[model samples]
Target chain A: MPLFLRGVALPFNKGQAPDADVLAVSATGPVYIPLAKEEADAPTLCVEENSTVAAGQVLCHVDRLPVFSTIAGKFIGTTMVNHPLYGSLLCAVIKPTRSKRVETLPPVEEPDTDTIIEAAAQACIYDELDGIPLADKLRLWRMAENDQAALRSILVADATENDIYGSSAWCILKEQAQEALYGLQMAARALRFSRYHITTMLPRNRRRALKRLIGRENVFTTGDEYPVTVYDDSRDDVFCIGIQACAALSAALQQGQKHTHTILTVAGDGVPASRNVRVPFGMDLEEVLQACGADPEATVILGDAMTGVPCQNTHFPLLPGITTVLVMQSHAVRTPQPCIGCGRCATVCHAGLLPYEIVRRLENMHYERLRYLSTTSCDGCGACSYVCPAGRDVATQVLNANETRGTIFLNWGGVENE
Target chain B: MNNITAPHIRTEAASRHLTRDVLLTTLPLCIFSAVTYGVRPVLIVLFSILSAIVSECVCCLFRRQSMQVIRDGSAAVTGALIGLVMSPMVDYWVPMLGAAFAIIVVKAPFGGYGRNVFNPAAAGIAVLSYCFPQRMFTYPIASSMNPLPTGMSVGDEVVTSLSLAAQLRADATPSITRMQLILGDFAGPIGATATLLLVACAVYLICRGTISCWTVVPYFATCALVAWLFPAAGVSRMYGVLAQVCAGYVLFTGVFLINDTVTTPRFWFARLLYGVSAGVLVMLLQRIGRVECGCCFAILLLNSIAPIMDRWSWYVWRYVTRFLRIRQEVKAHE
Candidate 1:
């Protein structure tokens, strides 16, 4: 029998104070929009410098997710800034006209799956939870629509936080319950599927309210383990969307506007107070921190602290998929001690591979030994890093090996290539 | 890039911290030994630790590796365990030379801490036992009196002629009570004299999760079972098992030495099997009167065979599962 996964229970500040309030934070400064500059598939820029653009207008195109201007503004040249998703790229700096002139889409009546996919592609409704574009997800679902087993369940994941310190996914599910339900209902209608599940990490007191709003049978409560709440049963079958994504879908059908505002959580040590706030996308993160009453001396980070990319500075604008704005005091660097083979990293790994042994094999360049050890099964969850007593970066080492070796080490079962 | 690596947060317990915990757990054993067998054991510990560190530093210099590798505290652990298992009445050079040899020959040449195929302390003790078979078997009488240094021992009250193993070999259970044997009144290695104190230390290590029950539990269980099933000549099964467990450093060696993380297999079942194999080997060696504390030799031998053990178990399991799958598919076709 497969066992329930064991993970490190993070010491989250589970106070009622932060969970009780919802603060409205507005971003007013120039929004810096990042353009992709990867090797072969960089985003093609559409709008140039000094060009005036309206809200929800397409700024650039990268695959199906068209980059939209969240605010109506004049394109005031480009600035080089570190993006949370793309690395260091040139960002289109826009001084918001601050006018209510959003270029809107016409609401579709009795929309089918194709209409929904087309609308999502035009609106740039990405699956803000896993950073996968909604168009891409829809395209996959569209291809597999004939095979009934291809799609199993549409999970509206609200339980993203393993600790009490992370995102506002659960908060959006609770406060905007109808909107979230509407989003799921629209997707179900578009795709013609019945099964739906909502997962949450809210306290017991708050659970009853959420269950009453979205039926108890459809809701499941879990601890702070991240991937558990996201893909509880099967990784391939289950397609998950955050409460923000669901609410965005609802808005696209009802309000006739493309993806604009984002609901994000601002919390951590250096912040004065932790609160869930809804701010327009492309708003400067520094302006958001000011509105949320964050201390200026505090270091600002975007996304989850465990797996999230650290922002070089707060000059960049908040994007659609960016969920949490973690403000905390800078931690001092600690020199890592050697691996003592305690096997704690292996014990806590969600993936069944031994991370410490893999790292040891890598250090010695024992490629054949690593291949047998299933080094490819590592999902880069950082659980090994969390439990390592020797302070070794087990995840980074495994990720490095996987990236460098590619498929050669991973194809053990003779199934991956096919 | 940040100066600090990824995984910005880490567990509170480090390798150095765990090694320090193991060293700290040995304190009670050390104190009990000092009160029973004088400061000779303590002196041996000090000498072994200093030599181990010096040898490791020299090895790092010779390899052109950074000298910063000495800060992990594994050397201190190996040295202390070697000291704890040594004969208190043996020459002072025994522990010092043994510890240095273990570090340079066994540990450092294999590329340091986690890379060694054998437990350093166990290998050291095994080598010492082979070199000076007569001095290695000598045991100091348990008392508050300070032990005379080796080569100047003359007083009858200070030392004993035959240890518990020697007594067991002659088919004559020592005249001391079982209670005396358990409570450190009998003659043995300094730290091995007190069964109660060593057990208490093992319980602490297990509770703190520094030591695992997978290794220590199966070891004692296997040792007891083997002794009970096949008692030695001229002793009841009960007495044989109790004597086997209580006599000669088996308890200390099982808890501390055999359970070394690097020397054992990764899987829990594999670890249990390793312990069981060591227990069987030790009992077999003891029955034939080959070694005094057979656990040291058994653990070192088992450590060398651990990789083979892992490979054998994996292949067996894979073939069994594949057979089951094939039979099920055949049944389904029928």
Candidate 2:
């Protein structure tokens, strides 16, 4: 039996991601290919300052991986953009030549591992498995293959949504079950992994539907927990991927299609309808919101409500990694209250770390004590912050401790030794 | 743009909502006390709540914080609890001072609201009990013809009144019957005396997810077990447990004060241990000396050790799981 992990049952409105229709937003404005903000060194640009480019053409290269444009456009220029993972980066701007034109490459015959990997790299398929390029994933898989005994199993986390209002992944699996299944098969066959697990927290009805698509023996139901969005983290060898990414892989292998379009679930109280729409990559979020009839005053968040980062600039392009866009009425920002020692944070912590104690240690700069407590175990799930009655930003504090643990220790400079 | 952290939204019940729910949950006890004692209790409650709110506002002004912090309803809860724990016979200034002290001194000085290490109301009651023992200990007796209004002054109409704790400590046989003690006919704290009503409100609070059963059940169980095993004044185990629980603020403190979200442990096992320790301490303090409202003092003492309880709970949980793993391995080998 698959064990049910310790997590708090959250009471929020659960809405299925709209999967019935795919509404495409026309690419009217300039498209931006944002470079990773963490890199101190600027990425090498493939196209020069005033070059015209076709859709699916390489705009730049970061760490030797190509960054492709989703629309046929003229190389307008570079502009500073607030990158999601990092703070800010210079984005290569491309003004779309045509709204509907999507460039494609010839599909390789007899789709093999290397061919698929190369096509994925050329097509700019970013797999969220490690939040790395597909090419990197292929390299990692190849390295893992050298020592097959080290491989435990592969976990396909088909648990469609991370938050109460999330359901896009479920919708994708429901609509394109065959493609997703084939993609999973191809991944397993390529890696030559015998043991694999498919997990979902979908209701019985949807589970039944998914079972028909991916055999019942492969499916294991999980409880309704927020942290289950990330598969069981205990098994370090388990290579987990979203069902949509799996389907995208199969599509890239079978058809000669590049990763040009992405399906986004625009839901919450701010929009007129909760929709699952197929939008071309590099299309502005504002255009998608206008199409969805989102409220002008509503706050637009790029991802689920629980752990989604608030979009400071909605004018930014929606990339392939962008999945859920929540447009909801802005609630009053709760001033962080004093820690009540309620222990609710500890209870809801999926990482099993005492968030309150760890945060206290972090705030006081007690690096050694935090290390003793294993503060780095935190998965940055934000479950602790979500359940805190005192409205403390618990996950952020824990995340700070994990990220800054090394810097703090280095800065200590043998003070304790004295 | 409201550029907050990753969690764009929060749990529906914020600290304000929770405090409001706690205030609402105490309604039944308030109503029962008003009917049984009189309007004096209500006035005392009103005065305390008003003073607490004013003191909080004043503190907010002094601290240069947004006056909006008072809107979280914590000061109101502190005020209401202070009033409930006061004797109706005492002057109105007693509750007013208690509420102000609870908020401005015990709560605000420690850093407002959730930062306070002690239960504000309990601390207020403790200070009052120490300073004005005579006034704080006095209570109005209810008669058959006219149950004296709770807020009314102590006069000839309320002639014969005995403080339950004083009477219990004096001798084995109490002036009031066990049933009367259960029904709260004698002089005691306004809300604390209403045993049945307080219990009902506690159940309601637990059901509403405002409080946890882990805190209450283990605390009560521990109290009952201790009182039963070591009877007070040669009384039977059951009767002794009833006397200990009913005479003082044991149940009321267990349900509200110890379970105060700001001061208690969060883990279920830690909470259980916290409850057990608090119950044991309450009984130990009661046996040692004449501490008026021993449970309140016990709670304050135990609140300081809550983090320790949490740490120990973590260690024990790891050990237990490890032991279970070893046992399973041994079984498989056999």
Per-residue lDDT of B14-83 in model 2, one digit per residue for the tens? 7777788889966776787778766777778888999999999999999999998888898999899888
Candidate no. 2 TM-score: 0.82
CAPRI band for model 2: medium
- Model 1 interface RMSD, one decimal: 1.9
Question: Clash number for every model?
Answer: 1, 11
> Worst 10-residue stretch by lDDT in candidate 1 chain B?
B147-156
TM-score of each: 0.83, 0.82
Model 1 over residues A115-179: C-alpha lDDT tens digits? Answer: 87777677777677776767676666543455454355454545556643664776776677777
Candidate 1 lands at a TM-score of: 0.83
Best by lDDT: 2
Residues B128-207 of candidate 1: C-alpha lDDT, one tens digit per residue:
88887777787766667665553523345555668877677677755767777677677777677688888888898888
